[model samples]
Target: DEPLDDENLIDYGLDSVRMMGLAARWRKVHGDIDFVMLAKNPTIDAWWALLSRGVE
Candidate 1:
């Protein structure tokens, strides 16, 4: 059951700890990534947009 692009990750069991871990790992490649960014909008489309933009 894949989650929808607009679906909130938290509703799919993505807690703070897991989100933090993801932020840490992704931040290695995407320096702009952070917990607050993800927490602000926990949706696949939003995250994809952020990650795809690439940091300056």
Candidate 2:
């Protein structure tokens, strides 16, 4: 929400609605994923890497 903020990308920090928004976006491109896994690993670098691998 602020300029040059590093917090947003690193932790995700997405609320229930916001996390759902991301889940929808990922689903559109890669298909459905369990939201619980995302909550367990909320970092973009970590989760995106996992998603890129189509989940392990």
Candidate 3:
């Protein structure tokens, strides 16, 4: 299910294990990332911001 950008992912059943796996997968391609930071916000928009931080 695609969640709205502003929606809280935890509300949609996003648990820590899933979050960790996502972080691990993303890290493999994006380099080191703050998993806690992504987990803290738990929103699609926030995640995009984190992922696109250094990209122009």
Candidate 4:
């Protein structure tokens, strides 16, 4: 199973479809996460900080 805290960005080698899946999941929990910010910063640690702060 995947780590609860990681984005699996490398292990799975994401394409656009995988990216969209991730964004959809975040939308369910966060509701305001735009793909633009995620595209701008594509690291798990960075996203973790953003999620913790409830960023929009």
Candidate 5:
């Protein structure tokens, strides 16, 4: 699906399992991340912000 940055991921079929998998994959490289919070704010912009938080 072509998602906009502010689009709700749930509206496009992103479920708990997919979300968990995404978090787990990210965790492999980024260390501990708040998956719950990420799920709460399910948007591309929010995801990018969360994932890039501590990077230079």
Candidate 6:
């Protein structure tokens, strides 16, 4: 089943290693993106909010 935008990614088997990998990849562009930030709220909406923002 596909996760909803508001659904928790961790609930769908998104583990820390994968999260870190994604954070690392995204950090290349979105410098502020970190594992901790994603881990705090692992949802598509939250990530989109972060990713779409201009780095400060």
Question: Which number leads on TM-score?
Answer: 6
lDDT of 6 by residue, 1-56 (tens): 99999999889999999999999999998888899999999999999999989755
Which pairs clash (backbone N, Cα, C closer than 3 Å) in model 4? Answer: none
Taken over the whole model, the C-alpha lDDT of each candidate is 0.91, 0.60, 0.86, 0.67, 0.85, 0.94
lDDT of 2 by residue, 1-56 (tens): 53133234434446767766777777766675656656665665656675687455
**Alpha carbon lDDT at 54, candidate 6:** 71
- Compute the lDDT for candidate 5: 0.85
| Residue pairs that clash (backbone atoms under 3 angstroms), model 3 | none
> Which whole-number lDDT from 0 to 100 does residue 11 have in model 6?
92
Per-residue CA lDDT of candidate 1, range 1-56, in tens?
67899999888889999999999998998888999999999999999898888455
**Steric overlap count per candidate:** 0, 0, 0, 0, 0, 0
Worst 10 residues of 1 by lDDT: 47-56
Ranking by TM-score: 6, 1, 5, 3, 4, 2
Candidates 2 and 3 compared: the better one by lDDT is 3
Determine which window of 10 residues in candidate 2 has minimal summed lDDT.
2-11
User: Which regions of candidate 3 fall more than 4 Å away from where they truly are?
Assistant: none
Lowest summed lDDT across 10 adjacent residues in model 6 is found at 47-56
**True-structure lDDT of candidate 6:** 0.94
RMSD of each: 2.3, 4.9, 1.7, 4.4, 1.5, 2.3
Model 1 residue 47 CA deviation (Å) reads: 0.6
lDDT score, candidate 2: 0.60
TM-scores vs. true structure, each candidate: 0.86, 0.55, 0.80, 0.59, 0.82, 0.91
